[model samples]
Target chain A: MTLFDSLAIAWTALRSNLLRSILTTLGIIIGVASVIILVSVGSGARVEVEKQIASLGSNMLVVFSGSSRGMGGRSAGAGTDLPIAEGDVAAIRDKVQGVIAISGQLNGSGPVVNGNTNWTTTLSGVHPDFATVRDWPVRAGRDFTPQDIRASAKVVILGQTAVKQLFQDEDPIGATIRVKSAPFQVIGVLAPKGQSAMGRDQDDVALIPMTTARGYIVGKSQVQSDQVGQLYIKFDNSTDLKDAQEQIETLLRQRRRIQPGAEDNFNVRNLAETMKARTEVLSTMTYLLAATSVISLIVGGIGIMNIMLVSVTERTREIGLRLAVGARQRDIMRQFLVEAVTLCLIGGLIGIALGVGAAAIVANAADWPVVISPAVIALAMAAAAGTGIVFGYFPARRASGLNPIEALRSE
Target chain B: MNSVAAIIEASQVSAPVAPQSAAPALIRASGVSKIYRMGDQTVRALDDVSLEIAKGDFVAIMGASGSGKSTMMNLIGALDRPTTGHLAIDGRDIATMSSDELADLRNGTIGFVFQQFNLLPRTPALNQVILPLLYAHPRPDDLEARAHHRLEQVGLGKRTDHLPSQLSGGQQQRVAIARALINNPKILLADEPTGALDTKTSEEIMKLFGELNAEGITVIIVTHEPDIADFARRKLVFRDGKIIDDTERAPLKAATAAKDRVL
Candidate 1:
């Protein structure tokens, strides 16, 4: 028989048992849909994470004080017998290459009073370069200047949430707010940053000059700086982050007189490493989910095999008739094989439609960024087809190996 | 009269019978044997049998149960291979032919009608007839036209679209005959073609077979009933896997006599 005739015959035979054919195809449908949906969800999550990471300012790095001895014995809250003085910032700025900006930060939780309004928020002391390093956007008014830090100026930047809580509908950019026991003018209002995945209130904070924080609140001096919390470093690009981190670690170790092979007390965290760690976690989760989802595909394959075996048995008479009419064994095998593959291909098409629709719906409902890649679509299609061929082989071979006389006699 | 009597006596004494050599022989078997093993015991189905059937001969094989008549039919139809001796169809030794070659020869040379009137259930009469044509010639164009023509020849032109289930037993057998004849085989082999039919239907089927024989197609009928065997011009009876009697009958003077009797 010609290819066309063979296909026509197989099609007719399959259609004769329409319900059975549909049930057999259901396995492939589920398998293909699961594969596509799982991969889509994984890619969706990756895209969302990439977006969040991008929002965190790609060039920024966080450096906390290490437990190394320096000029001052031990700074307050500085655990180390050594202290990371304010002078180290200047030294690093002068020594490090590709260093764009550097800043010192001190965090303290407190309540601020604006007229009749009072809101508790996190207060942070920062140098003039803090805004540049952290990519902090000033929505209104000006950022702190070098002169302000030098003179211990009473000016502060109110985060979006802090401004909203204190001023409500009124503009609080140039308003006065009391911090600790002293009144300070609000120099700027920062933009809203929403909440992080860990449920941290990113916008509930205030930024002030380091000098004013040291003199009025903490009572520390710039030259002898007894307390320092974190140092924020910004590099020109991601490529320079590693080199700068290593150079800074080496400089700090040498300055503190630390020996080789000793664990450094300071933790250097660059956005790239944090991004890598986050991606690793997301990838592991995706892999686990994908592995679990693939179980459905295997089950579906088994279902296909079972149905194909039944089909082979049910069509024994038809197969025998074909064989007796001069049909080659290979021809019978090809006919069954084509039927199986055709079922899977049809199922695969339906599955792709269902999976894409489902993913789109879920992504829209959860407000996630979903990117459906063509490679994933092709992979799922190929996997479904491969499952059909692999699982459909044995039963087809059994059908081909049947004795014509016996099969015809099987009624 | 004396010479004629002497010639007849000498002929009966020397050869018992002399087969006509004018027509070419289509099938020749020499000491063909078919042994079927059942469990540990072996049963001989055809024991060292020799037979010759010439072209355009309508032959009937008659036998009781376990007489190996079916085995002979199978060997002649190329459906089964002989275990020993030479069995030839159209001068080609089938015992030496490969399975594929036998299939090809069967497709080209033989058509079979089974006792059950083996018309595939649910298939249209037209499709049933065209099935054999699918095996003939790699390309099977004009199958519909050929099937229609064959069905018409079998007096089933209007029932071409009707399925086997819709047709009566005699009509179904007619459809099977049409399928057998569609390939224009050299020989038509019918195994109890009217076994399942009523008396009248059986006579009608026999009449159709006689008409086909008249058209010069070598027709072989295997039957246990004397009435069914009477339709053929030549009758061979088998007993214990061997031919016990072979006889020839005079041709019917009028084909309409059988048709009128059926009516």
Candidate 2:
């Protein structure tokens, strides 16, 4: 028989037992749908992490002061070593080839008052360029000027949370707020920055000129004269951030007079690198889910084989009639094989629709971004056909091997 | 031979019949025996039987159940190979033929009809007749037209669109006959073609077989009813795997009787 005729015959047989065909396809549908859905969610998480990394700062690096060495020889928490000095910051700023911007900050918390209302909030002492290095654009008024930093003027920038708490419905610009009983003029309000990966409200702090805080707000320093606790640096967009971070670290080592082969006292943290690491983690999780779902696909394949076996047994007489009518063994084999592949293809099509629908629903319900790629659809379809061939062969061979006399006599 | 002589004497049936032709037999079976093994036991279904059926011959094999008549029918139909000895069709020895070759022979040279009509369910009459042609070597290009022609030839021209379930028992048998003739084979082997029909329908089916034989196709029927056997020019009787009687006589006028009642 022609291949077309064989396929037509296979379709007719499947149509005759509609309920059985549908039941056999259910397993495959579930397997493909679950695999695609899980993979999509993983991709969404990877994208979310990349966005978070970009939010922290693009092409940026944070240099922490050296950790303290205990008497027992183990390192202590960061900032225990000598704090970074203004001269060291200026040296790095002048010496690093790719250094585009530099700023220093000292962080602490205190009660700030406006009229009868008082709010306790963490405050930062920083250069005017700190806002640019951190990508924190001011929403209402102007940023602190160079003159403000040089003269150590008592000017301040309020974060969104601090503004909401102290100002209520009133405009905070040009208003006077008390910091440690010293009055500081509110210059601007930083735009709201939502939350960080650590679940902390990022917009819950204040900014002031570093020179003012060092001379008046924070009192004296123990580690060094005119030292800031942290240094923030930005590199040109086209320059590789890792290269800039390495050049900065090496310059710091030489300035600190650290011996060769000794562990560096300071640590450099790249937020982008951490985001890439999380992407790797998400990829591993997706592969694990794929493996588990492949097991389910095999189970679904087994279901197909079971149904095909039953169908062959029930149609023994029909097979004998075909054989008696001069149907070749291969013809019979191809007929059943076609039936199996048709079943899987149908199931796979339904599964693609289900998976896309599920991804959309989850995206809406959980408010998480989801992506459905063509690669996923192609993978699902190929798996379905492969499953059919691998599982359908044995039953088809059994059917082709049946003896005409015996088969006809069976009924 | 002895029983043949005895029946001839009792009926005083006409003078000894003349051989139809000098042409070689279309089917040749010599020393053929079929043995069945059911686990540890063996049953002899056909015992060293020899027979020849010439082209354009009409034959009926009659015997009760377990008398080995069905076994002989299967062997002649090329559906099974004899356990011992040789069988040939149109002078070609089938003893050494492979299963594939046997299938080809059945496809191009032999056709079979069953008692139950053996038509595929849900298929229309025209499509049913085209099934055998699908497996023919060099599969025909004009399949629908050929199937339609055969259905028309079988007097089913008016009901070609109806399913088998919509047709009468005799009509279903006619459709089966049309399927058997689709490949234009040399031999038409039928096993109890009217076993499921009423008496009047049986006569109509027997009449159809007789007409096809008259058109020069070799026809063989395996049946247990004497009245059905009356339509054949030759009758062979089997008992316990042995041919107890072989006789040939003038065929009765079954087609006329069929036309007088229902046609």
Candidate 3:
């Protein structure tokens, strides 16, 4: 038979029992839809992670004190001997080639009071370049100048949440706020930066010049400074992050006077490591969910096979008539196979629409960043068609191989 | 009267001796046997039986149940291979022909009508008639036109759109006949073609067969009914897997009139 005739025969046979055909394709539909939705969710999570990473400064690296031994030997709290001071930051700026900015931070928590309203928040003492390294934008007033740190001027920058709690509708940039009985003029109010994926509030803090903070708040001299908690380094570009990190690590070890073969005294952290960890966790979760969806698809394929077997039994006489009319065994097989594939393709189409729609709804509800690629759509369609061909083969073969006379004799 | 006797004598002498090999016989069988093995027992359906059918000759085989007349028809129709004999349809030996060649021969030369009518249910008359042509012809347009012409010839022109289920028993049998004739086969085989119809419908079907035979199409009908067998010019009676008697019917002008009226 010609290709058109074969298609006509297959079409007629499928149309003969519309309900059964639809039911047979339900498996492929669910399978295709599940694959699409699961993959979308996975990619959506990856995009979310990248956004959070972008929020933490694009070219910035974080450095904190580590144990004398390797990781897991001791916590940062256990290591009072490893002190990262302002001198190491100056040495790194002078030695490194791609270093753009470097700052040492001392963190302390206390009540920040303005008039009668007081809110507890972290106070970070940083240099003038700290705003440039950490992507901190000043929304109102002005950032601290180098002169403010040199002269130990009593000026502070309030974060968005701190300003909201203390000043309400009023501009708090030029107002005076006391940190533990030391009054300082507000130099600026920083832009809002929302919460991180780890659920830490990013905007509930205050910034002050390192000299002023050390002199008045923490009460330590430059020579006897012992409370430097963290060091923040920024690269000219992300491409230089590794080179800058390696140079700084060497400099800090030499300056701290660690001997050869001694364990490192500090940890180097960058955006790349955080991004990798987040991607790995997200990918594993996506695969697990996708695998569960595939189970339903397999169940759908079984449903198609079972219905096809029933169809073969029901159409025994028709098969006999076709055999009698000089139809080849392969011809019979092809006709049924085409019918099966067509059923699945229809189901696959419906499933694709449902999956995309569901993903869109979820994305809207959770405010997620979702991208539905054309390649994923095509793959889903191909997988659905394969399901039909694989599951529809055995029943078609059985029908084709039936004895003509015996089939005719069957009631 | 003298010529009739002389012709009869000539035929009698020629029957004992096989005819000369120059003329191509439409169907030839020599020592043909069909054995049906049921469990451990073997039934000799046709035991060393031989027969020959010439082109453009209408013949009927009559027998009781289990007489193996249907088995002989199957071998002649190329639907079955003889177990221990040389059986040929037209010039091709059944045993030597491949399955595809047999199918081709069946498509081009042999047409079959069954007692059950065997019309596909829920199918239009035109589609039923066009089915055999689909296997025979390459051009779909020509097949459709030929199918329509055949259905019209069988007096089902207006009923072409009606399904087999909607047609009467006699009409359904006519549709089967139309289907058989669609391929324009050289030989037509009917196995009790009118057995399921009433007396009047049976007569009409027999008359239609007679008309078809008169149109130069070789026709064979298998029937046990004497009245049905009487319509054929030549008849053979089967008994216990063997042809025991072969006879020619008396010349009847009434048969011609009945056939002409049906056509």
Candidate 4:
């Protein structure tokens, strides 16, 4: 018999018990729909992480001056002390071959006052190259000049978050903001950099010149005249990041007068490596979700097989009648096989629509980026067809092998 | 009923008997024995039965339940194989024929009718008739037309679109008959075809079979009712898996008169 005729026969058979057929395909529909939604959510998260990492600046490293081997060789928390000095920053800038820019940061936190508005925020004292090293640029007004750092000028740059809190959308470019009761002129407003990979607000700080911070804001507690809390370094490319890190470690040990057998007091953190580990964890989570959905799909296929077997039992006499009328074994096999595949394929199409719709809903409701690719839809279809074939074979084979006389005798 | 009128018209046409010496037997069973094993007990359904049926012949097999009449019907219909000896249908040794060849034989050479009027449930008469044609090799392009013609022959032309549930018992049997004739098979094997019908409806169905036989088709029926057997020209009585009586009856006119008397 022609395949078209077989399909028509299958269609008629399914239509005869329309409710049962639809219920049988429900398993597959839910399975495929879940697969699409879960995978899209995973891909969306990966995309968000990539954007967050990109915002952190590429090929960058941060050196914290806390003693990693504090007492009894125990490690101390980052930024606990001011061990990195202004001389160390200048030496790295002049001597480090692969380093593009370096800046010393003295971190502190206090309330900033503009008119009657006052907001508590972090304060960082940095050099002019801090903008280049951190890959952040001022969106309005001009960046701090080297003259501002050399003269300890009372000037400040507002981050986007600080600007929103202090100025409330009013122009803060030439306005004066008091930090810890010390007045400083705002030179620029830094561009908005949403959230970091750790979900920290990136634009919640104000930047001031290093000389001004050491002398006016936080200079009274300084043990050394030029000591800074941390140093931010930018490399030319990621290819030589490991080699450059090693070179800087060796140079720091010599400059800081650390003996060959003594443990280093500073810690160099590769932000790219930390972000790479995070990406790996996200992808692993995606795979786990996919695996769960695949299991559900297999269960759905088992449902198909179960229903098909029951159908064969229920229609034994009908199959016998067809066989007696002249249908070959293969013809009977094809009829049942087509019926199963049609069920799965129909369910698969509906699942694709439902999945895409659900993804759109999630994207809107949860405010997450969902990647719905054509390849995923195609894969879902292929999986549905394959499941039908795999699970439908045994039942179809059982039907074709029936003894015609016995089947006809069955009620 | 129109069935009586059709019967009267069918009886007027004399069926031509095949020339015995000139034509080969359409069915030949030589020393055929069918055995059934029920656990440890071995029962012989057909014990070394040998017979020959010619084309254009009408035969009826009569026996009680478990007397091997159904087994003989199944064997003749090629639905089951004999355990020993040879049974051939249309010159091909059924024992040696492949499953596909047997399927072809069943499709192209023999038609089957069941006692229950085995029309597909919820299917219209037209599609039921078209069922066999769907399996025909190089399936006829004018399938609907052929099914329509067959339904018309069975006096079901107006009811072609009616489902089995909507049809009367006689009408449903006619639809089954129409389905049997769709493939144009040479032999029509029926197992107790009139068992579910009233005497009037049974006579009407037998009359239809008589008309088909007059058109040169071999007709074989298994029925216990002697009145139903009277409709056929030849009768065989089965007892304990063996044929005890084989007789040739008078022509179609005698059976027609007997059916007229019942009406």
Candidate 5:
């Protein structure tokens, strides 16, 4: 018989026992739905982490001077490494082939005064390339030119949060604000960036030329090491990040003359790597949930097998009748197998619809992005069919192996 | 012409024996026995039985409960293999044919009707009749027409949409008969076909069988009731796993029997 004909017959049988058929597929429904939800949630988390990390910066590396010890786990204390100077920055910029931009930074924080308002925020002294390296474009006024860095001009760029607190409704560009009684002219307003992974507001900061901060804001140490606290390096793209990071680290080590056996006083951190670690943690959680889903799938298959065995027993006389009418053993076997596959496929389709719907509702509620690709759908379908075959085979074989004489006599 | 001679003269149902030669038997059994192993002991269902049924002949087998009549029917139906002898239907050796071949023999050559009608529950009459044809390869395009024709032959054409639960016992039996005839088998095997029907319905069913037999289909019925067996031209009675009596008589006309029911 044609597969379509067999499927039609199987469908009729299922419809005749509609309630039993539906109950039989409940296990499959729950199994398939849970699997789909787990996969979507995992991918959603990865995407979320990538987004948060991308906001921090893409294809970017932060080079921290001194040992890796801090309140936040990465940033180094100022004046801790005297050997990491502006010359090491120049060497990395010149030697690293994937380098897109690089900047030197010296940092401190203090209260900024404007008219009657005063707000405390981070103050960072950086070269002209700092804003572009961090993907922090200025929103208004004008960028501080290279001449400003060379001449130690007291021009400053205000972050969005700092502007909001210090200026309120007024345009602060070209306005002068005092940092610890030292007057600084606001050259531009930095664009707004949201919170960091650590829940810190990223926009609560100010940027000024490194020369000005070294001389006036955060006065230079007496050793005259020309030391900048950190360096930010941007690569061409994410693909080049690893290679560029390695090149920068090697160039810095060579310029600083650090021995191979000694632990270097600098640490190069890839922002994407840290984000990937968080993604791995999320993926582990997904696997744990997926494992539970798999157990349910097997349990569902067992249910199908149990019900199919019972069906074969219940329809023993029917099997005999078909056999008497010249249906081959294979035909009897195919009939039951088709019934199982039909049940699973229908249940799987419903599960997929339910999973997608649930994922969409949950994602929207939690403010997460969910991707439902065709591949995942196909996998679910294949899994359902496979489950049918694996579980249905035994019962089908039992039915086909029945002696017609004996079967006909079964009540 | 004698009744036997007349039957031999007009036979067109099965086998390819020369007209000038004696007609080869449609069913031939030689010393066929069926033994059942129940636990450690054995029970002989049939023993050393030999018989020949010519094509287009209507025969009735009668016996008590332990007389092996049902066992004989099962063997004739090809539902079981003989223990130590040979049985052949349509000139093919049943002893040597594989299970698949036996199934084909049953499918193409024999039709079976049970006492209970055995119509699938909740299935409409038309689909129940179409079950046999589904297994026929190179499936005929006129399947629905064939099923309808058989239902019409059995006088159930108007109730083709009725389920077994909705039909009377007689109507259900008619439906089963239509299903059996749908494949146009050479022989019809009815086991106590009238056992479950009332007298009037039993007469009606026998009348239908009589009509089919007149159309050149061989008919074999296994019944304990002598009145039901009276409709067949030949009769065999079994006792103690053996045929103890065999007789031939002019069959009772079903029309007269139906008329007698009113009187």
Candidate 6:
């Protein structure tokens, strides 16, 4: 039989029992829709996470002055011990290759007052290169000059959130704001940075010269007068991040005169490597979810196979009639196979519509990101067709193998 | 003819010879036996039965249930292969033919009409007639027109769009007859074709068969009813897997008024 004829015959047969045919496709529909919905949601989350990590700056590294193992063998987290200094920052810049920009940062939290409006926000102390290292640019007035840090200038840059809370739509640039009861002029307002991967508000902060923070605002450091808590480093595109990290570790160990087999009093984190690990985890989750969806598809295929078997049984006399009327065994097989494939294809198309609609609803209702790609849709269709072929083969073969005499004799 | 002369002539042709006419033998069965192993007890459905049916002949096979008549019909239709001995249809040995070749033989040379009408439910008459053509390789281009012509030939032209459920028993059988003739096979094999019909409907169907036979298409009908057998030119009675009685007579003529009226 021609393919068209087979399709027409299959369509007619399916239409004869329309309710049964539709019910048979339900499993496939649910399977395909779940696959699309879950995959889109999973990839959407991955993309959102990647974007958040990228916003922290490209090829960036953070060095914190805390021992890999603290006293009594308990490890201390980053930024716990404030022992990093200007000398350490200078040493890393001068000694390490590929260090495009480096800045010493000191973090503290206190209330900032502009007239009667007071907002408690994070205060960060940094060098003039902090803007380049963090990828945070001035949205309004000029950033601090190197001379400002050298002279312990009482100037600060306000973050977007800090600007809003303290200035209240007023231009905070060149306006003096009191930080911890000390008046400091806001030199610039930093551009908006949304949220961190850790779900913290990144824009609720203020930046000031490292020298000014150490001398005037933050008071004396516990370890030393010129102590900085952390160092932010930016690297050139050509730098291999792993090798750069290793070089910095070696340089610091040598400078501190640490003996072999002793835990170093510092930690260097490659932000890209951490983000890559996170991406890998996310993709693994996506595949796991996809694998589960595939199980449902197989279940759907089983549903098709079950219905097809029943159909063959119910239509045994019809098959015999066709055989007697000159339909070859292959013709019978083709008719049934085409019917199964048609069912799956119809289910898959419906599933695509349902999946996309559900994804859109999810994105709108829960504020979740959902991405649907053409490749995904195509894969889903191919999978549905394959399911038909795989599951339908046995039933079609059984139908074809039926003896004409016996089939005709069946009620 | 005298009774003695007729008896001598019948005895002379007791072995079922092909007619000495212009029409060639369409089906040749030699020593054909179909044995069925029914749960370890062997039942011979057809035992060493030999028969030759000439083209354009109307033959009726009359027998009770399990008398090998249906088995002979199936073998003639190429629906089953004999366990031993040869059966040929249209000059080809169907016993040795592959299943696909048998299908081709059935498609091009033989048509079957079942007792149940065997019409597909919910299918229009035209499409039912067009079904066999769907399986025809290098299928005829004038498919719908041929189906329409066959329907018209069976007096179902105006009912082409009526589904089987919407048709009367006699009309349904007519649609089946049209479907059987769609391929224009050399032989029409009807197995108990009138078994499901009332007497009037059966006569109308037999009349259609008579008209078809008159048009030079060989017709074979298997039925136990002698009344139905009276419509054919030749009758064979099968019992215990063998032909017990065979007779030849002039076919009963269909009435002229009934011939033209659509049932």
Best by DockQ: 6
What's the best-to-worst order under lDDT? 6, 4, 2, 5, 3, 1
Query: B212, model 6: CA deviation in Å?
Result: 1.5
Q: For chain B alone, what TM-score does every candidate structure achieve against the true structure?
A: 0.88, 0.89, 0.87, 0.88, 0.88, 0.89
Deviating ranges (above 4 Å) for candidate 3: A51-60, A65-84, A94-266, B1-24, B250-254, B257-263
Per-residue lDDT tens digits for candidate 6, residues B156-263, read 889999999899999999999999999989999998899999999898899988777756678899998888998887899999999998786565545232234312
lDDT tens digits by residue: candidate 5, B179-240: 88988898899989999999988988998887777666788999999899988867889987
Number of colliding residue pairs in model 4? 0
Candidate 4's docking class is medium
As for candidate 3, its clashing pairs are: A27-A300
| TM-scores, all models, native as reference | 0.73, 0.76, 0.76, 0.83, 0.81, 0.88
Q: Highest lDDT among the candidates is held by which one? A: 6
Q: Please report, in order, the local distance difference test score of every candidate based on alpha carbons.
A: 0.77, 0.83, 0.78, 0.85, 0.82, 0.86
Itemize residue pairs with steric clashes in candidate 1.
A68-A82, A69-A82
TM-score of 6: 0.88
lDDT of 1 by residue, B1-263 (tens): 33333332333235334424436789999999999999999999999999998776778899998999988987897767899999989999999997778777777788878677666656799988887676665656899999999999889999999998899999999998998888788899888888899999898888888767656678899999888887776789999999999986543422454224322
Report residue A16 deviation for candidate 6 (angstroms). Answer: 3.7
For candidate 3, lDDT tens digit of each residue in B120-224? 767799889887766654545687788889989888998989998799999999999998888778899998988899989998888888677656577898999
Candidate 5 lDDT score at position A103: 84
Reproduced native contacts, each prediction = 0.15, 0.55, 0.19, 0.60, 0.57, 0.81
How much is the lDDT of residue A360 in candidate 3?
92
Error of 5 at A222 (Å): 15
Given candidate 2, what's the lDDT at residue A71?
36
Which stretches in model 5 have alpha-carbon errors above 4 Å? A50-60, A66-88, A91-100, A105-125, A130-145, A152-229, A234-266, B1-23, B255-263
Q: Candidate 3 at B34: error in angstroms?
A: 3.1
**Clashing residue pairs found in predicted model 6:** none
Kindly indicate the candidate among 3 and 5 with the higher lDDT. Answer: 5
Candidate 1 lDDT tens digits, A252-304: 88776778976666766776567768878877887787677567667777877
lDDT of 2 at B73: 85
Q: Write the per-residue lDDT of candidate 6 for residues A126-199, one digit (tens) a residue.
A: 89998898888888999889999889998989899999888887878789889999899888989998888887
Q: Model 1: how far is B76 from its true place, Å?
A: 3.7
